[model samples]
Target chain A: MNNKVPNNRAWLLVLPMLVLVAFSAIIPLMTVVNYSVQDVLGPNARFFTGTEWFESMLNDSALQAAFLRQISFSLIILAIQIPLGIGIALIMPKRGWQASAVLILITLPLLIPWNVVGSIWQIFTRGDIGLMGWGLRELGVDYNITRNAGDAWVTIVLMDVWHWTPLVAMLCYSGLRSIPEAYYQAARIDRASKWAVFRYIQLPKLTNVLVIAVLLRFMHSFMIYAEPFVLTGGGPGSATTFLSQSLTTMAVGQQDLGPSAAFSLIYFLVILLVSWVFYTTIMHMQKDKHPHGGA
Target chain B: MSYQLENTQRGEKYTTIFSKVTPAQRRNRNARSRWRANCLLGLYLILMILPIYWLINMSLQTNSEILGSMTLWPQNLTFDNYIGIFTNSSWYMGYVNSMLYVAMNMLITICVALPAAYAFSRFTFIGDKHLFFWLLTNLMAPPAVFLLPYFQLYYSVGLFDTHIAVALAHCLFNIPLAIWILEGFMSSVPKEIDETAYIDGYSFPRFFVKIFIPMIRSGIGVTLFFLFMFSWVELLLARTLTATNAQPIGMIMTRTSTASGIDWGTLAAAGVLTIIPGILVVYFVRNHIAKGFALGRT
Candidate 1:
């Protein structure tokens, strides 16, 4: 969409956001870039080590493991959440008091603090006291996150699915609601099967929101820190040590500024690249669907 | 005449069979599907609420009772954990500090994003597309990356451990989100409205405040919700930027685990209390959430 009047005065409107973002985003980012290249020896002493940290960070086996773990975690989350969210959205009540009640109930998890989410799961999954833990124990299953890496990984993933799937469901619910009634009516007249209706009508209409949900879930899962940090502390032998946790350990815990800075850039680049691919691919798909540039 | 009567009777028999079988079968199918939908949702709801219910249950019980027993309901119900939080300055102050910073972040993000989103929706400016993408990149940039820099920068500027520092730091992501959401809502409003208001002698600020803002009130609400949620829940930046004076409840909750052991009851109480504010917010905006979700890009 374009306006006939060619005016640049609109920059005045966007100036505050630019300045605020620059202060919060660009300056700090530049600081990271600066630290990535130079070895911070002391409070005042530093030496230029051009790409040395980057080279070593790239070769660090632990960091490589973390990168792979991060990718797998994100992929798993997306795979599970996207379908589950759509399923819930499909079954969700369309209107009336039930709809409102369900919406409020479902969104409760999304609003809770991240650390608190971990804390809830932490206690909930404790074999000695919590309901799930005790129930599993009664069933003769030993479920302990602290002692078992598999348990810890499953607990972390489950915690995330519980926390974030509502977001995708909510987005899909909105997208589903926006579909014109006429489409469904037309399908009914044609005697379209339930799956056919969903595949052709609902899913196609949900493409926009699905794109948003996928990208949002991907970015969020990639940057996940607090929940896993609080829940497992990237523990049980580093089975759940994702990218952010690794960066946090280096930058905050160990104070390894140069290497952590390099790690941060790499992490940022990975997210940016993936998000860009998602954005372009989805946008191209939309363009192809509408040859006349109609939204 | 006998042959004609037999043919009509045969037609009637076929009609009866069709009517008898189809409607009952359809009703049964509908009933069965509805049952299935209810069961699926019912199971999901249980899964969703069980942890929360467990938290609440633990909050109402003594530490020993929680650890020693696995009964469904609290064996010995008590409010001591909650009472402890309300009475303690450190505990209660965590809530206050979190609320203060979250509110400030919401205010700052909306104030800055409104005009910027307007620019993006209304006019094509130099580097507009690039700048928009750049802003969004900040949204995707992990908060972990900024923790070190934010700590050093805020300490240097004497804003460390202040609510303002955390609020400002949260702007890194919230502002971009606010702009994106507000931009989506604003673009749906026709450009002709702005021109008509201006032609009627409404100044820019007057028009924006009186007309445009109300039109996008739901957008603002959604932006506010997102900003509030992110700031309230964000621990890394908030934790890094603050210490005692401005410690958020989230960070404070982590202090429960020490050399001794975890304080199950008190931690549960605090966790339950943390969810209350968000619940209240959702309740107020419950009606707008679906609409807001549709309007807001993300």
Candidate 2:
């Protein structure tokens, strides 16, 4: 390594970033901490309440329900997407013009704006004018996502799958494509079955990309707000109301900044804890298989 | 080389290959596999296109027609809905405001992330690793959690209700991701290049702008595109930060269903328009994302 004496050179490089981040991220976070312990009665009236807000937020049942709902939703989404994404990737054509066309079609949904995703689904599921609603009716299946909680759950889950599975699939495709042709040739020369080839070679190579996909999808699905908000309005009696919606309603609708701030902090901590567990466990499993650095 | 070619030809000629042994069976298996693959592909394509098809179908129908029918296609297609959104200022303002903040946010994210990412990738400074991880915490924190403080801070600073407020708020998330993606890319450049630049008497800024940036153009383009997409469609902070002057299409889409009932047609038309810019951007950058994801490490 070239030892340029650490002469504050890197600091100079990162100075502008730190300044921008301080204004937008650090300052605002400190402000949140300040608000978390204080009472906001009016613009001119403010008083410190210490941890009272945290104490109150801990006992709030609505917040608890929202937390549970969001966790379970994230779990379900990951369970569906990871496996389904792999299956789609497996069957996809590996070369030529058809693969390019297929890639575009698969990626089309990922490009749509989040709110428009919600809007499109909202109209698509409406019983009055929606094709899905109309098709289900013609098929003699009883369906009303707007009013029924079960239907609402199905709709949101399917919507998320439709939107995110492509991301997983694309990541997996890249991972698969990166495997050396020698590995495939060796497997074929050994008369290895398709399942054996995939199990021994393809799966191990895909581990890193899959890990990143799972982490990204987990975090995003946990914090999802706009899609469910636009679709159900967190309604059908809070069946679709996840954590972000609860935080929003508390802060904006009820003007309960004290509880909302505490709730938010707790939510952040929970995500951090869970993601740490996920990352660490994946590393442990990986190490058990390969004593040396796998990559 | 000639000896290797002769060895391969002799080996292949002696090997027992079965191209002619099971033609009928192979043809039957191929047909079956083709049919199975077609079914799966068809189903997936339908799943992907159904929602978009429905949105377009509804956009072409009137409110009365929508409420009256349970049909796949609109009985009478109309242009009134498209007309209403185009003619209405409130509807079009969403496009204008979203475009403005998205541009500003992109500019800020790039300017900041570029050098910060460069530092993280090219140099190991005090607490650099820890600081990088700390920055990622912003990624984990939901926009909803930060709403109260951001609103209060922006309000106190006299930045509320302006495009800058939303753009700055979005920098919270976008900056972290930009740094992460950019750093991954920057680290892949060989260290020898920097020494070469130094030997040529180029300063850090000159080296970065004139040489390094050009080398990592694809990575920078991908990061910029991703940031633009994230900020453009983000709703929670975008809504909380701006009310009257800088509201985005996400907020406008929500307010479409007010006391007057849901403007189904206009919402659909607007929804279709909202997706066009993102689609166009993705079309140009489609080849970059897959490769970019694993630039420095896979």
Cα deviation of A254 in candidate 1 (Å)? 1.3
Candidate lDDT (C-alpha), each: 0.86, 0.80
Report the lDDT of model 1 for residue B81: 97
Candidate 1 docking classification = medium
lDDT of 2 by residue, B1-298 (tens): 1111111111233222533324444445546665687679778988898888888877888978877766568889898988888898998998899999999999988998899887876677787756776677777778888888888889999999999999988888899889978876776677789889999999988998999999999898888778877887788898888988998877887777889788887788888888788777776776666666553344
**Shift of residue A77 alpha carbon in model 2, Å:** 0.6
Reference contact recovery of candidate 2: 0.54
lDDT of 1 at B57: 91
**What are the runs in model 1 whose C-alpha is more than 4 Å off?**
A1-5, A282-295, B1-28, B295-298
- What's the TM-score of each model vs. the native? 0.94, 0.90
lDDT of model 1 at residue A281?
73
Give candidate 1's error at residue B127 in angstroms: 0.6
